[model samples]
Target: MDITSPSFKENATRAIGDKSLQKALGNVERGFIYKRAKAVAAVPAFETLRDAARDIKNHTLAHLDLYLEAYADKVAATGGHVHFAETAADARDIVLDICRRVEAKTVTKGKSMITEEIALNDHLEKNGITTVETDLGEYIIQLRGEHPSHIIAPAVHLNKEQIEADFRRVHDKLPPERNLDEPVALLGEARAVLRERFLAADVGITGANFLVAETGTSIIVTNEGNGDLTQILPRVHIVVASIEKVVPTLEDASAILRVLARSATGQEMSVYTTLSTGAKRSGDPDGPDEYHVVLLDNGRSAMLGTPFEDMLRCIRCGACMNHCPVYQVVGGHAYGWVYPGPMGSVLTPTLIGVDKAGHLPNASTFCGRCESVCPMRIPLPKMMRHWRENAFARHLTPPSERSGLGVWKFLARRPALYALATGIAVRAMALLKPKGGRFRTLPFASGWTRHRDLPAPEGRTFQAMWKDRKAGK
Candidate 1:
């Protein structure tokens, strides 16, 4: 996806001021924050487990290439085909080729952020294949013709009434008078519709939570068992995942999963944790006849050996977004890309160019909640600051901002000049201070004074006050 970082400011301004969005966001923020806290509180050992999870990821990323090769070998040994893709196009092409070989007319998918990142559904549809999103949230967004608004809750932006309307519009078999106001009723209707698709689908596609090198297994976590049916019922199963997903064994995968659910949706675990080793064994009643695992590189390997290598440890738990102040205001769409929040700000500029996504780094309040909550312990704010510094050095920032920073830098380097300027500014601000210590309009700083007042300084500067105290003593 192409991103225009400048649009971030405008979109964020509109999103924050939007009442409907604010209402929707308010519920989500409360729901995620509180539920996660509750879940974490329930699990007394959660913090200690987080450390284990972090170490597992750190170790895996350190030897990523080795594990990837080991995983490819294991998959091949278990009668599964492995395809290495260096880019998104490469991955999409490989999947399309597999679909053509299998003569697949319809494909059912589990919700995979990797699939969204690759724009797999669009790619498949363009090639005349029908792609069905089996996950409820993904299905709703698919019908609405919109991207996922949140990582875990794809249709989070929609209220129940809007969902009812969407279901009514999309469910052609539904009677005009059918009442669907209740959540359970709406879900039942969707479940019935999807059940038929699952049986009819020629292929199943999903993103792996982790690829186990020891057993050649691809793991997926879901609250609903739809992912189970999606992978097993079809004739062909294709696993699309990034290379960073590889782990040494099921034990290591479990270590990561322990933290994944807690950091993500705040469940002790998902309702269904399915691990597929390969195609169906001899005399097996379910699962695909053929299994294909597509390991996507897609600039991830490039991040290795760079300061950004720590980012590869991410398990997509999305805790950072939950705690992020900037993300809470604007939501994911305002980031103008698939990924959002603290992780997006750091990763987007690297995947796409710093020149295109420089604004994301500068959009933060830098409260450090993201770093504190991150399971991987990624230093997000520091990384964002690194991007900002890079942008400044490269002159990728707006010319106006660059000029302003240049003036500030010049003043900052000289104490006498800075103090002189500060005294004049404090004196000027005192003159501009209106009744009630507020100004609707002021000179030079009308940008600040137009909407809010510039507070008048309290007499002497800190340096001046300290010096006078010393002199008196």
Candidate 2:
């Protein structure tokens, strides 16, 4: 809930030293990536679906105002209240107002990044309301008093052993001798604990994966059915989501849904894909008595028709983060914000201001993996480059980095000088090599050399080798 983004460098360094965190991060690659590849392979038209999804989002974002108006009308028509929040503070207040109206003592919630972005739980608790997380991964992090490290898998930074310990420590009423060695046992304990909270809570809250204009419906895709219970079992249901989540029609939403699960968790479909239009109707057997939707802009409106407009197409499936090498090493917590990874790198600066979150865009290796994996085909690396240039233009970049780039730019403009400078630098590096042809320490390169040796320049530069090959007469 705290904005530690300014201390991202320190957070990353600390995360590197945590063995448990490293071990937990390993599962991300070995599990999600591999499964997603297999899932994509099985679907022959997966690529086509991706392009279709991207187009749908592009079209929707271009006419976002129209769709949002239509969505609001549909919600009103269904007897649901639609609240527009221009900022995070506005969103928090709207939720707080609803809670106060109901005299809510406790609120049960499904996983929602929008809620995290607004710091909803902290604000509610500060106002004397108790918020209980119903999702298993969310419940674990809630018990540990930590923010989500991963978007979909909130507790991905934790392992089974850590979870066992958290449960034992938090669920004080449980028998001390109970076996929580297995994942099933751990899940069962959390389920039992959350079930009681769900039954007793006065209000329910959730995040929407998609909002349909034609139906005024909020959609949630989850492996666990906790979201359903979070919404249906309570007296009042509230949906907290960003403005970008709205889609024009049910057909467009269906197209996006086709790729959402495969891109996020490598499944054909999530176990639970629930859609709700509004509160219980006259004929409805069982449902909530009240329905409300909080739509937060939080700086998204300023991005339209700008260079960052493409970022508005994000579906929040989290494929970009899942495939990012930078995210893989440091983990999401290092980004030090509600959103982390490639999408976060671009979006956080937009929402929270570039000065505070500039390090996020700079953290990428720009390998293009995020773009390739994204179902929406968002140019994540290009957007990050835009941020880098913005930072440089504003003089927000450190003096050393700015000077280095300035020198490089000066040399790059001259072809002959650039080649000569690189040739001489390569020869000098070769001469400085000791014994194993590696440099353990180098001035201005301690950041890299501290962790791994820099391989010595073997001979001439690649340009020289290419020139020799081309001139082989």
Candidate 3:
């Protein structure tokens, strides 16, 4: 996907005006927030699990080199191939080489964000290999020639009516009068259409929720069973994952899994928690003939010791985005990259230079809901602040914003002048208050007033109010 984080303000402005998108975004709050809260409330130890998950990831990342080495050794021992990719292009080439070697005509994919990050589908299609998304949400967006709006819920930006239209448009062979008015009807049609593709696909690619170093197992947690078929039915299974996914043991993966589902979908466990170790064994009834894991770094190595290191702990559960006020309004596409929401705000700037993605970190309202709900307890707001600081230090921020901040800094350093300035401004605004006690338009603040009215300041400033209260007035 192109780096449109640079145009986030424009994208968000457009998103705010999109009635369909606004309707679709309502699902985030209605579907995710309450369910997650109820699920966490049921599990009294949920907070403890979050702490454990954070610690597990921290320890693994601290010793990531050793764990990755151990993971590769185990994969090789189990007859699976491990390809280390330092860049997105390298990862794409590795997968392409594997497909070419196997003479793969068709490839089936489970929901893999890393592949999206690398633009793998476009690359494969351009190279003459047909790639099909087995995940229902992925398939819908793929049909529309768009990327995922939300990580866990790829087509969350769409409604069943829109999906029905896309299905009618794409699956032209299906009966024209078939009822796709409901989500179940859409599911049945997708299942029927994808079943044949599953059998015909020569290669299957999936993203790992966790890569167990102890057993060389790649684990995927999904509500639907698409991931199982994607990795099992094909002749070759390829796991594309970032290096941070590796954990020291199955026990560690289990500890993290406890919080993953609850935080992600509010389920105690996903319907399908599939783990693939390697190729088919001597007496195996059904499994892939070959297994490959394309471990991608893609700038993650550079984040190991930085403030952004905590972002690598993300399990892609997407709890942060679900509760983020800004994300709930603008949706994910406005952020313009594979990942979205608070996680994207921090990670995008790090992965794609801060110069290009400087606007993302500033997108947050700093509500701290993201950090509170994060399964890994990642300090999303803090990391975003770091990005803002980095952007300012590098002079990547706009000159107007810099000048505004510089002026604020000058006033802030002088307490008396700051107090006098605020008092005068507050009284002036009070005198100029409109009939409704809100400013529909303000000089030098069109950006703030463009979409909504800003409330007029009260007649008294903080200093005046504080002094009056202290004197018992």
Candidate 4:
């Protein structure tokens, strides 16, 4: 809910040292990477499919206004009210207004990063409505009073023991003799508790994977059936989604869905894929009485016709983070926002401003792992570099970093001075190298040396060695 970005150094240090979080993240990181690799390898046309996916997204973004208008008309024709939200505030207001009109008290929710981005729950609660997150992972994080750590797995930071502790704290009505050690038991208990809330909820809110323009259907894919329940059981169903989520037709949505589950969790398909066209139809056995779709722009429309347009192709599969070295070490919370990793680095800056999120782009090792794994094939590192350049252009980079770059630039312009400085610096480091060939402490680089010792720079500078070899030859 907080708009401020925390210090990267401080948050990253804590994230790296968190033992419980590391244990949890390790299992999740390894599992997803392996599964996705297996799925991709099994499919011979995966790369070609990615190319097609990229093209579809590019074309859609190029004509976003047209598709958006078409989608509005279609949804209106289907008896669904569609509201356009130009800002986060507008989106939240639209949902809250619907709840107020219906005099709703309790709201059941599916996992939606868009809702998290708009801070919908906090706003609704402030206005005296109780919102319950239905997905198991989301419910766990909600009980812990923390934002989601990972995009796909909100409770990825919590180990079983931590979850047990949280459940014991929240599940007060549990019997004294209940077993809280195993995951199944905890899950069953949560299911029982949430079932009651589901039946009692007056409204439901969810995020759509894609909105079909032809028939005005909101498509949601989930491993658990909670999303289906959230949309159907409540009297009112509200979908909060970004404008880029709309596709031209169900056929187009199907093409994207083919790659979505495989890249996300390596599944053939999620357990539940629900498509709601409108509110309950006449003579329908079960469905919401009212359906509303809030299409949020929230700075996304500005990305149109820009290099960042490719980023909107993201289906929120979260493959980039699972394979990232920095994300593996620090986890999602270190990014200090709702979205994390490569997509987060690009999207966060656009929505929140480069000045605040500038550190995220610099956080990368530029190893190219993210770009390689991204299903959308977004040029992630190049985009991050663009953000860094933008930050530099705006003078948003720290003064210390600017001064260091200035020194390097000054020396780099002169060959003689550069070679001399390199030779002296190499010899000085060689001499100051610790007993085992590593420095335990350094004056200007204490931040680097604090966590891990730096190995001594080998014998001579590259230029000096090259000159020596030339003279001898």
- In terms of lDDT, the best-performing candidate is 3
- The per-candidate count of clashes, in order, stands at 0, 0, 0, 0
* Count of clashing pairs, candidate 3: 0
Sort by TM-score, best first.
3, 2, 1, 4
lDDT (Cα, tens digit) per residue for candidate 4, span 1-473 = 77535476678888888888788888865679999999999999999988888778878888888999999999999999999999999999999999999999999999999999999999999999999999999999999889987889888888889998888888887876789888999999989999999999999999999998889989999988889889999999999999999998888888888788889998867888899998999999999999999999999988887878788989999999888888888888888888898889888999888877888998899999989988888999999999999999999998988998999999999989998899888889998887999888988878778878988998589888787899995
> Candidate 4 regions off by >4 Å?
427-435, 458-460, 463-473
lDDT order of candidates, top first? 3, 2, 4, 1
| Runs off by more than 4 Å, candidate 1 | 1-6, 438-452, 466-473
For candidate 2, what is the total of clashing residue pairs? 0
Off by over 4 Å in 2: none
Question: Could you give me the TM-score of model 1 versus the true structure?
Answer: 0.95
| Model 2 Cα lDDT, one tens digit per residue, 1-473 | 77888898999899989898989999998778988898889999999999999998888888899999999999999999999999999999999999999999999999999999999999999999999998899999999999999899999999999999999999999899999999999999988888899999999999999999999999998888999999999999999999999998889988998899988999988899999998999998889999999999999989998889999888888889889988888899999999999999999999888999999998898999999999899999999999999988999999988888899999999989999999999999998888888889999978778889988998699988989999993
Each model's C-alpha lDDT?
Answer: 0.87, 0.92, 0.94, 0.90
* lDDT for each residue of candidate 1 in 427-464, tens digit (9 for 90 to 100): 67677677777557766557667657656665456666
Model 1: pairs clashing at backbone N, Cα or C within 3 Å? none
Clashing residue pairs found in predicted model 2: none
- The global Cα lDDT (0 to 1) of model 1 is 0.87
For all predicted structures, in order, the TM-scores are: 0.95, 0.96, 0.97, 0.94
Off by over 4 Å in 3: 467-473
